[model samples]
Target: MKNKFIKISVCTLALSLLLGSCTDDILDEQSRTVYTPDYFKTEAGVIGGLTGMYAHLRYMYGQAYYYNATLTGTDEATWGQSADGNFKDADLSGVGNLNSSSSRSDVLWNTAFSNINAANGIIENASAVGISEALVSEARFFRAFDYFLLVQTFGGVPLDLGSGELKFNVSQNRTSVRNTVPEVYTKVIFPDLVTAVANLPDAGRVTGGATKTVARLHLAKAYLTYGWWLENPNNIPTYPETPRTDPDGHNAQWYFQKAYDIAIEGIDNPGPFALQPTFYDVNVATNDRNNEILLMADHTESSEIFNGGSLTFGSGGAPDNFAGWMLTWNYTSLVSGTTPAWTAKVSSVQREAAQPYGRPWVRMAPPQGVFNNTFADKVNDSRYDGTFTTVYRGNWDKTTLIGTNPVLYGANGIAVEPGDAIFSFLNEEPSQPIDFSNTTYNSGIGAGVLPGRADFVLPPSRISRRVYPGLWKLGPYRTDNAGGLGQPNAGSTRPFNVAKFSELYLVAAEAAVKGAATQPGKSARDLVNVLRARAGKWRYSNADNAVFIQDNSAAAVAATPAVIDINYILAERSREYFGEGYRWFDLVRTQKWNELAGTYTICGPNLTDVTPQTFTRTIQPFHYLRPIPQGQLDAMDMPDADIEAYQNPGYE
Candidate 1:
């Protein structure tokens, strides 16, 4: 229950100052300057250092560029119309290239090591300071967390930052060595997470604190990922040129079975986490920080200082939760008119500080395949409706454009009001013929018109790199925007969810499909059905803009194939966690990135260019691992050959 933010200084690592305080959330700011070893030996210093671990998440999670690195270039997303090199480079479609410098994965690389050092300092000195083992386990969890991310991203980052392995380095040193992938998992990630799971309490000490279930989730995931590495199903190459053998003398199936057991254990023993009754409830802005979320990078709307970024505006920088804006198209460009011929235009769906109408950067967009295939059963499954902002409603009342006439002319010259649907990305092609010609009402964004509907409609196939359904799950949400457009430009105050309880189901199913032995009533099909059944029960329809209750659990569960394969599990994962930044890792873990995401289809950037164009990614065996960041290599004082050896295989 004791939640206080403290800032501690380490000799080599430049840990940032902590900001703001909320009950249950540990990322509040308070400053103190102290040297590492002695500082962590004190009780205040230990707590302060632990708080730094939570704060470091802000540096990566909500940062838009880093978020783009995780989802873009994968099947779930592509570079949008306004995408710059950061996005285009990741796409791997030849527009630009992903390399050591341009890759936004640097966000993780830069932020994680500093915090890892902080965690190291805490783990070493906490016990001496009389800090509880429970408190120390928090440090242990973070240590493993960073290394897990590092090993997955760069394939063998240094475990010994400057000193001996896992030791708190008290002096600055530049030279570094990359460990083999096997060494990282054995020496750091797996061991620390195992201890963390055993020592951490069922309930978090503070809001958003690490707990047993979270530790179990990561530990299980580590086993699952390591299992895939051992199997090397696709014969993908590894970095540092290490063999895919586990140091612990276990085979891939051993790890797979362990992954399944631990995940099921976590699911059965969920202390304060469980699935939300409906997917809509899980992501609704009002329902932020719900129980379904196991871990998140915490943020707040109350104060600019506490939020770690401006509440009124954001520059799309680190510590700002602006990732949502990247997938958001420029909906404010939509024009409605006063006359039947639609000459006098006004912005009908003005940008607002609400869940659906956040500021748009148009940096990354979903491919048409996401709409047509991944979520083909739009009616039986609520995930498609829950995941995207398909409808852009009129909020002109919130702007000065509402002057005198409360009504505006829309598609088919129908009169529209403030709450009417202005434009919509239809879930499916309408039975009625849609007129795509721009001669009528210039809907501005290449949207078409149906006969009776006032809302301009674009069917599934019409989705483009310029305009597609915005990621509704990650949109901005604010309670302070009273009567007018609030700070839509500001980063979202909502916590960026990092892990969810529902993922345990997917992880277990994936492991089971990989030849792990399943328990009674816990087969791969059974595990997937748990979530599919939940997808059927919908309490609110996002498209209809109303509370329409329906339970299609029978149909949803019945639709599940009797035999579930790895592909089905991957498809289900996309439905559950799309655009939430889980795609790349999921595909990478199962070695399905090239197979699933190699070819994708999307229309051109211009509104009128709705013809789908297929693009191919040149994913090579060496691309399985991202390049070791150029900045890290440049900072080190190693020889040119040593540095060349230090980088991942492809980037050189």
Candidate 2:
């Protein structure tokens, strides 16, 4: 609960700051005055230093780079536009574009090290300055968290545990060697997290800070990830110990048990962690900072400096626009209904007012197949409807047009209102023919068609390109500046939750199924059923009941309890965590990347003979770990041959 201030240089290895009070009055102004080691001995100074260490996290989680690395190349979503060479190459073609030189890859590497160095500064100096052991624990948690992500993304990263080595090696010689994945986990991540659990308080964890429970949750996750790695050691060819080919000696079950124990500790630990009653509570802006959120990439909505910029903190702070771009549609480019054509159209106030809709960026989209294939109970599952907005209302003033057109039905048979549903059934096949003769249906334009429109109606094919059921989970939902500056210029920002309590249940269920944990009377099926039951209840709730009108009620309910497996947990994760990030990592950690992503399709049954399935893509085994950034390899002070040796296998 300390609100200490620190002025940090994001690019550097040191976190230098003049300690400031927790109150905003003291932190409102910026100062460059530096404090001595004696200053850090005080509680405020240590907290201020901890603040600097936490600030670097925005670089990793609060941007498109991380999402691109994690979300693309997976089964859930695909690149929407063909022009983005990065997405096309890394995600679709599964080719060589994602090598070390990639700007995104380079930033991830730099950011991870920069934070790790800052954490090291705090940890090493904490003792010299006579700071609390709690500060050391917090610093270690961050060090472990950064190293965890680095190892997962790019295999072994350079391991530096102190400012002196980081500054001497990283800043000067670039001499730090890339540690192997297993070594980094065992040597750095695990120990730091264990210490973090020991020193931190039981609760009151914030977005940027960790609590004992938070540390435990991550420790569990770390165990789970490492367990998977042990089970599939070929993925970590650089692991120091003898690989587990026989799946016996300290196999995945061993770590899975550890993960299960820690996760159960967090569950039984008295804390504000629990699943939200309704699926909607987890995402809506009104519910920001709710108990369900374990950690979030916190953003400032009021301050323009926090306005989204592409990894450049100078534009303001590191407020990310992940929500503005991902899972959103460019409403401004919608095809005009009057033209009956698939051309770009501007947005209106009516369209702009919608809280969950945004101007089209069209960076990522899921194929109709994602819904049809993943959600076995698509209709009854509240997560499907809760996450996606299947309707877009027309902004054009069509009062006169509606008065003249008797067949244009609104809800029942009422006149078309400004915000009435203008688009629906977006999950339907693109080539499916529209029945304009059905006067009751408002398929944009049905019978009594307005002038200047064709009699036979065709659903806007460009919706797939521009507005395919915009994701509702990621939103500040702007009413202004629909498409002014694009990617990072989100006119308004929304807080992005990175981890939720819902995942703990899935983790427990997975560990249970893997025979790593005991549930006594309950099975893995029972744990999953708890989530399914919540989703099903939401489906039948008064507000959402009508949304499932198209579903076969009995069939949808029947699908929930019949079966539960790893695939079911994965599919449920896809439904629950769409575009919130972590899909690619989820697949890779579970060793399902190649199998699931190699055979992904976007259009599915919607593909007509002429359509050619535009979004089919595949993944290769080498994609299990991202290629070590070529920039890092080049920047290494070592011989060219040595750097090449350090590059991840198959990338060179």
Candidate 3:
């Protein structure tokens, strides 16, 4: 009921469930004394049960927002924002460290278990009292949901399959670890989700909240990813030099097929939500609200779009920072080039420095390479207009939009100087390369810019900044200029930003192509085309295109063809979901990583201290799974990976 942003008015009337609030100052075990079997005997108890789960969500939910964006353990693509930037160029020697406390995995692990406990209480009592089988489905679905997050981030965690049946000494007892990857999947996730799919009403069954179908999405993902099961060598048995033909372990392809089936089933059912009809239908400013794929999390309230408005992933810029940090220079270019091209204010120096703090989604610039390659404009891609743009920040009416004060001031904020060209990103073939005075890069030929040569750009034409074809679409609200929405430091005026949908479409498309289903029973090829066609980048006609073409996994494995490898899926996802915050994860899954620190030094003299491969390795570490939170390692008695090393010792 701590409604800092907007409180749900109907929620108060919907329930008389005011069991009690914890007397403790914060979430601690000592304060949680009111709980008892008799406590959840009424409908109010059900409401209380649900809110108890909701209370623990902010940590994991917020973490997901930011972590999803800067997935780079360390990559050049890292805009050096939030925990992402810190992990990219790992530093423990430094005074203040960023990656440790802010990580969602830590929060996710703890909160998931906490919610699981509440769910345990509900499952034990909900059935006997019999509050609509629907409500029971909700509890089970949510329980599955929490575990699903744990399964992905930490692998097979301590599964508390048993509920509040334990009391007395049980209150002080910690949960016991259980079931291997296969066991958890077969027992907990699989069965619960299957029940949810059947008895839980359709998508919109409980409008304004999660329904049965949403629960199925989690099932689909669990089946698709197959969680820690992928780790079992017995399942994915080690193969010979060439194993594609020999065959061995669990077919990852099968799980993906199941994922596609679940997704399609939900799509067919038209739950409480529907994908935005057009790119224009999406409101980037809000960051993420009312999204079709958004199973949980509320953006209507405060600080949802904490990162870079709509340019970066989940968490943009909420925490404060000092000057001289690289933000969405490339992102500005991409968003500017977008169809309704947003133009940002131009300034030589940031009047305000962006510090990496707050949530994961920060509106930092994309790496230089991304600007040039993947997300850039290619013959007027429909997504180009919606996704990419040049202007990194804008000035707009915030009072009317979200009833908030404006963030930027012309006399105070961005003081544009003479010859400072502000770029607007419109999705047309770029006529000429545009440059910013502050652009920095590593030289191919020789040492270009250096400390010795302070004067980098010889002429105004040779600006430090160069225009790449892509746009930073995540942060629709944030900018150094803070011109949009009127406040001097305001992030965005829009309320909802959709980062998951576009990217998920790509995920679904790729899985569908692996002999899954293009149109239910037909080839999965058309599935690819449907998505590509929507993006305005369908190269082939229906079945003729690379996406629509038949994909023989055997043929794919034989030639290491682009058509069937992880690269195609990754790249396509990058194209579809750029700025949505999955970049780092996508890279890790593919094992293509690099830290940003020294990837772009002025060409000419190579610094012995830093190398391109250093960045590469840093990024690779992220693939090992994000560095495990030190606090978690310290808190747990379990044997852990090298915690001091800032490595993600990996999930159990």
lDDT of each: 0.86, 0.57, 0.40
**Judged by TM-score, which candidate is best?**
1
- Residue-wise C-alpha lDDT for candidate 1, range 156-228, written one tens digit per residue: 8887777778988665676777789999999989989999999999888766669999999999999999999
Q: Is candidate 1 or candidate 2 better by TM-score?
A: 1
TM-scores across all candidates?
0.96, 0.80, 0.62
lDDT of 2 by residue, 1-652 (tens): 4322222434433222111222211122333233334445556655665655555555566466566667766777766652275555556554336665553555566666655665666665677667767768887888888788877777766665233433312233454456556667777888899999889875543453577877887898898888887777345344223444322346678888988888777877837577777676677666767777776555554444333332222232243545345556554433233222322222221334234455455667666556667654545677776777665555455333223322233322333444455445433344434444534333332212332332222233323433366776675543233533222344335556767777777787777766775756346676666667667645232222243333243444456555566677787788788777778878878877766776554432221321325444545566566776665565556777787777776677
Candidate 1, lDDT over the whole model:
0.86
Residues forming the 10-long window of minimal summed lDDT in candidate 2: 17-26
Residue pairs of candidate 1 with colliding backbone atoms? 18-29, 19-28, 19-29, 20-28, 20-29, 24-207
* Full candidate order by TM-score, most accurate first: 1, 2, 3
Error of 1 at 17 (Å): 20
Which candidate ranks first by lDDT, i.e. highest? Answer: 1
Candidate 3, backbone clash total: 106
Backbone N/Cα/C clashes per model: 6, 7, 106
